[model samples]
Target: MNETLSLFGLATTPLELLSFVLSVVTVWLNIRQNHWAWLFAILSSGLYGGVFFDAKLYGDMGLQLVFITVSVWGWYQWLHGDDTHERLPVTQLTARGRAVAALAWLGAFAVLAWFLRSFTDTDVPYADGFLTAGSLVGQVLLSRKRLENWHVWIAVDVLYVGLYLHKGLLLTAVLYAMFVVMAAIGLRAWRRSMGQHGQASATMVLK
Candidate 1:
């Protein structure tokens, strides 16, 4: 599966190509608020773990394992995380929640970067750690149906493009570039969903 082939004039493997397709589908379903996205997320993350390992990106390889675990929790959350055990609704974080998330990202970055730098021979430990931390924040926010998850994804995906290119993963770099655009679309879509949820809540109160 790792055998190299030319696609779009760039060298890539079947494993990476498969992961790319699954990841795209995963994000598209996520934008639509479909629970099945988590299933695809798990598959893509597992595949990408092998791909990243081959590239010697230990941080990202480790992150793919985390993603697999989180995807399972995220699947359950999407199905029954809301009050009364219904599907979760789109919602924004409170001010304090946002502050906490930001702090968590920074703190995770510190620990991950230090560990990667000291323990791993990977050349881009800092970048890997930083992006890995950001992705974890985004994934948690997404699992809870938070509206700001798209914002975090936008930032992380943008940086991921450059990182993948530096690692000579041309197809994955293009995938992240596409993710940036899809994340913007997701932001707009979720904002509309949040507005609808708010209206529904107000109606229930009025009733």
Candidate 2:
């Protein structure tokens, strides 16, 4: 056990430490509804992208590249997507939207799993595909200011904690543990903001 732990530590090294720190900052910025959160997220994702490649988590490594592009889109959306120059409003997904998102998740998972199983020696192809697909959905929803994004994040992040631990990546496991807590906080905060926005919209309608 000790030897396994030491091996994981060697994999982490100093760059992973920097990635961990940046990830924390990214989550903090996200909680504050800052557009710059995406910038930090991009940096953190870029660092971890390489780390996952080394760890043979090919799906996650590829997801980080997608995250970079999404981060740019997110930054733009948060800044200019709203009409009043305000930060993007937190809103829940509609029923139709939820249905569509579910379909996307399923499709992505199936395709990714097949590709990974065929092309890579990944040990847990389905698990990796599922988490990666779910995370992609969460990131897209988050970029669009969807309140339900945190729920998806909380679920997948919990799974990731166990997955990383099983893979013997202790530090990455710890990072996901922190992500779980942050996701909870983000859910509460976004829900509160959504309530406030709803009330304000109601007031405007009355006027």
Candidate 3:
């Protein structure tokens, strides 16, 4: 029997099962606009870092470190990173912000892919780099409470599901599949919030 498949009733690695639970909780909390999710994010990232390291997915392993930092930054952002020291509202990316995010994603992909290609013997460097880069963009957007973050997550998590499957991380693949669904749900919920806010602003203007 595979030890990795000996954990929960679902039969996954201990780290995988734990990370899966933490990540799911993190996403669900985020969907409800809760800041506590970041704490879980940090823990999940740490566990996944070890899992990816053992799996020889060096790029993803490095990404887990980045995720730890991003989770910390996000925690602060949700609590007091607002310009007015108040809770930040769901917002849209500015046109310039969109451009910058695009450039950042491209640059991250190029640099990480090159580094993985030159320094690591990992076979999925490009795929790993691509997903890692996308995660960076998604994490930043999420930290800022940008509504579009869910879209980024949906796109990347789908690819992640496939990649984890290819890498034989069955549990991680299942988690990413659920991430895709959660991202979609988050997008819809956030869109409703945006609409409600818009209506409120228009009503205020009329009054």
Most TM-score-accurate candidate: 1
lDDT of 3 by residue, 94-186 (tens): 999888988999999999999999999898989999989989999999999999899899999999989998888888888999999999999
Off by over 4 Å in 1: none
Q: Please give the TM-score that candidate 3 achieves against the real structure.
A: 0.92
Please report how far candidate 1 places residue 31 from its true position, in Å: 0.2
> Which ten-residue region of model 3 has the weakest summed lDDT?
1-10
Candidate 1 per-residue lDDT over residues 31-107, each given as its tens digit: 99999999999999999999999998998999999999999999999999988899899999999999999999999
Candidate 1 vs 3: which has more TM-score: 1
Candidate 1 Cα RMSD (Å): 0.7
Cα displacement (Å) at residue 39, model 2: 0.9
lDDT by residue for model 2 over 1-207, one digit each (tens)?
A: 112223344445566677788999999899889888998999999999977887789999999999999999999999877887776899889999999999999999999999999999989889899999999999999999998899889999999998898776778889899999999999999899889999999999999
What residue pairs clash in candidate 3, if any at all? none
